[model samples]
Target: MRYERADLMTGMVQEGLQALVDGRHGDPFSILGRHQYGDLTVVRVLLPGALSVAVIESETGKVMAELEPIHEAGIFAGLVGSPVPYKLRIEWPDAIQETEDPYSYPPLLGELDLHLISQGTHYELGRTLGAIPMEIDGVDGVRFSVWAPNAQRVSVVGDFNAWDGRRNPMRLRAQAGIWELFIPRLTHGERYKFELLDAHGNLLPQRADPVARSSEASPSTASIIASSKPFRWNDADWLASQAKDRTREGAMSVYEVHLGSWVRIAEEGNRSLDWVELSQRLVPYVKKLGFTHIEMLPIMEHPFGGSWGYQPLGLFAPTGRHGTPEDFAYFIDRCHEEGIGVILDWVPAHFPTDVWGLARFDGTALYEHADPREGFHKDWNTLIYNLGRNEVKGFLIASALEWLEHFHVDALRVDAVASMLYRDYSRNEGEWIPNQYGGRENLESVEFFKHLNSIIHDRCPHAFTVAEESTAWPGVTNSVENGGLGFDFKWNMGWMHDTLHYVSDDPVYRKYEHGSMTFGMIYAYSERFMLPISHDEVVHGKGSLLGKMPGDAWQKLANLRAYYGFMWGHPGKKLLFMGCEIGQETEWNHDGSVVWDLLDRPEHAGIQFLIRDLNQIYAKEPALQFSDLHAEGFQWAVADDAENSVYGMLRTSEDRSSHMLVMSNMTPVPRYGYRVGVPDEGRWEVVLNTDASIYGGTNFGQMDAWAHRSPEHGKPFSVALDLPALSTVFLRWRG
Candidate 1:
């Protein structure tokens, strides 16, 4: 096993409280004490089978052979004292256990506890929180320290001095492997970042404030928060009074919203909605939509106006582009109060070209793996963490936990999960490192993610975590026991790709691939999934859903309605990109505003109504919920006018009394008195119609009394019904 040390501290007396552990390989690591409050030291010996363990003073290093055999499994005691550096070695003989599976090793829990022995009054200052409120007391002359042991030089940059990257350089404290700087008269809103110089005499990029309250757009610096906590959350009461019967998958109907574009501040001229305004207005709007959750695009600090929160600079900080840390926290609190769950679009797979944040952190591959083959992602122009490294793993795990604990987000939609799953992701053969197993599966990354999911579920049982995985990675959302990633839901990319292809084709061409609709059902059964219309489809010339359709205005609406109705009837959960419900005509533009004016037209209103009604009907339908999965819940067949491109199915319940029949005709020519098979003979009420006048659809069918009974077909009876061309109808049997 490899050994490492804890951090350094200063001005302290030394005392050993206990001999923490005795390794089977003759060595002893002890917990040492210091006089100063909250400071500790640890020392490790590398020899086999330590005969004994004892703390020796500098004057008595070779004077005594006092020792005792270590009996405990490992150290569970804390240490305190000035950090001191020392070493020892011993010998023993025993075969160590080696398992083929790397995960068989013992888990590392809590903060790491090991440091070199030292005697001094020189340690770096560190904060113990994710973000600080702008109200620290007597901290103007507080010392600042960073653990950039590899860097030769370090500088401080912040918003206090116009985004300067090197206004104040920190002095290197060599014995402890750190850099220290003190800024007097520092106040809140004084944004800051670090600039480091590597051993090669190269000035590394500026790093973002890991804990900024709010940040400018990406590429800008992070603000130095005053380092205080002031939010008064009744979390215990909140969790107790709350009743969450919502299944991570079943209750998942996400509204993909961009805080900036959802609403704008008219008073600020061109300013978009900040976190505060969005929190207030959006809670009611999202709750009203009947969606179970809201997924915000990347809200982390980033540079560049066009960034959709994808290229993140701040890993632990909420974007200052909106407001302060408190403001962001208030937003989350308000969301919880309104009973609207929020899912952050977390970008752990890659990061932006943030010199002031993560790039070349510590003037070397400190946060990232030193090897470019494993550390770099060329397509995204970002760095991938060395998931195997202890510190790297700790950083990511801590970051994830911070979001859940501090912000109280209900779920995390991990972005670009595919990139994290494979080592050679998006790279040619020569461009990536092969894992120990010599395959695309990055075992270390996979193991780390599994651990992450395990910890999240354990800590916050109600929290939902989803993966935006595009690849056909087996078991993306399966249980960890089944050797899966354990995401609550995985984006059904197959559904999106297949459905888009089928809808974009002409009627004649669609017939050839109409079966694509059922192709994704197989994957849906294996894992809980979300049929998402995420930002991926809208950005970069992919165009809007309307623009992707193959027909004119009427056909376009029909195609969209058909697609949505089919999705609602499908087994998986649903997610709609913003502006899609009202049928935004233009492609999604990150910078330009959404075509909100389009909703004024009746056509758009109709689409919106259909969506709303679908939500209502979906909630009430048992077949839409029961087994929402199993193949037994679904039945498919070609309509009698198969040549006209028609298909129908009945989403049936186990008891069969609560079945719903859905039929659609793609042809523009209406089919009068068409027959569809049903399970029973009863009065069928037209529960929902895609061609209703209310939804800007051509009035093709009567809203009331479109009932029919089934002929004696299979177990007992069957029925025939009238089908409208280019329309979908949901019929519920009223026995």
Candidate 2:
């Protein structure tokens, strides 16, 4: 019976040691580190290049035992008296080194963190999942973690380990699918990537940390171990003001900028300015131009710069092209201190499919859908995020919060929202899948948006979200509790399309398309809108906003000036892409900086001055800012004047105590005596005239007009004035 008793078949230990040598061990912590082998304190370590190893007391630095080579791969093991605080003293051919053993410590990830991460509700992943620097058992090192559920094994590999996966295989918390390891003596600024074997034990390309806070610049894709030390903030006043502005009723004139080419150092290989330089130069420029906010094109780290950050991979990291993450934070703090709100263009709709990215993670369709119909974006050649996965949704939510809460960004302009809202977006009928209800609407994405928006509003009340949805999606800016997606604003793409088309036609032909200019008011109040002249309108051979005008150089400047006047005077807040303000004559080049030399020309400089004045007027007038979201704030004074190409819009305050009239004449023929209706009777002074010579126009419009109590164009008060050729005038009325 004693011989039949299976003597604890200890062959599994040999197999585990073999697996450790092969770097295929799934649980490194179980076999390595300080383990009690039935009263014998056994210590095992994998130091690939070490010729000799000694276990030493961590405090006194006394060598306790010499470890013999267990395998040719340089793994060493020895039985000490008992488990005590210790460090590894190793000798290489060229050098001898001493450091704390990585595997000597217990798991640092907590039970609550594991539970929240598994449930896909860990909003603070920036602190949880990435390579975090911490001290474990009085030993200083970095705790690296990643979530790759189907990986047979995962390792933290970097220069320190000679990029060898076998040196630092991690421990998997099976319930959460996260593999973690704490490597002693590792500190900030170390570059690392995760090497994983697929569930089939086939090696895959190393991947950058999905929650990395810092990344190497484009063309190089290593994740950097960043210092988690908090930035010293000086924007408490700005935050307090934002908290008081729950309604966000003030004017919002956003200057859309692409940091890469906004300005470049022509002498320094045409390199873009760093964050410090931008804070010194770009911030003052935008503020001087009277812009209230600056919306940067996605600053997220991406592999290709030409995509202009529209296709991004590192959502949690600001691109290293500009500067370090702290430098970016300083830039934001500077913007707030200068009273300029900062908005980051966020791309949660999709991620580029780089092998080292989140695509095919763990040899599975992890962050994206397995099926092409639901996962691929043919137009962009990118992979759509699988928001249907609760974990992925949580990941993106945590990414957004990283910006809103950690970076103190004022807003997020969610890009390509239309793509997320529809399953068949930019696809043929057979190339798409339907929801459970057999509908084209992406129901999972809808729920994700509602959930994300609700969480964001509940947590960060001082910040808001805007949607770049091209479609007429209902309730885009409505509250989630009212069955809406709960965005604060939506881009007015229809107005941009219709008005750009109207302004590009010859004056005689413009009369035929006059309805294009006035049709926006028909449904303007359906959703809160921001009329965006975005970077999309300026790039990819579309030409500059100025180049789109149909006329001679002088007339083109006048046309653009009139359009800006009309846009600023019209309903909704404003957003103008860079280079448009100075009337850039060429299509935007992502590789080059803005043509600041264009300002040397009188016509171009005129356009710049015109935009500055328009922004000032928009901000100074409460009727233009606060009365934007409701129909009661607007009324048509002249809508059916296609023959004369004249349209009049009367903007009134919510209390009706203040009013302004915007009369736009699309034709070049001067109307010596044109009459337009106004809301009040008295003097209606021309607050702004786009025709003034300072803005490169004929300068032939009346300075002011008298509004009599006579009915004209369905209003009680009528105003008579000489309307300039191709001009928009803002007539402020006071009784």
Clashes of each: 47, 0
User: Which runs in model 2 stand beyond 4 Å of their true positions?
Assistant: 1-12
Clashing pairs in 2: none
Per-model root-mean-square deviation over C-alphas? 14.1, 2.2
lDDT of each: 0.63, 0.89
Who wins the lDDT comparison?
A: 2
Compared with the true structure, what per-residue lDDT tens digits does model 2 show for residues 111-161?
999988877799999999989998877778899999999999999999888
The true-structure Cα RMSD of candidate 1 reads: 14.1
How many clashes would you count in candidate 2?
0
| Best model number under TM-score | 2
Model 1 CA deviation exceeding 4 Å by range: 1-145, 153-188, 200-205, 211-219, 234-246, 265-267, 637-642, 653-657, 702-715
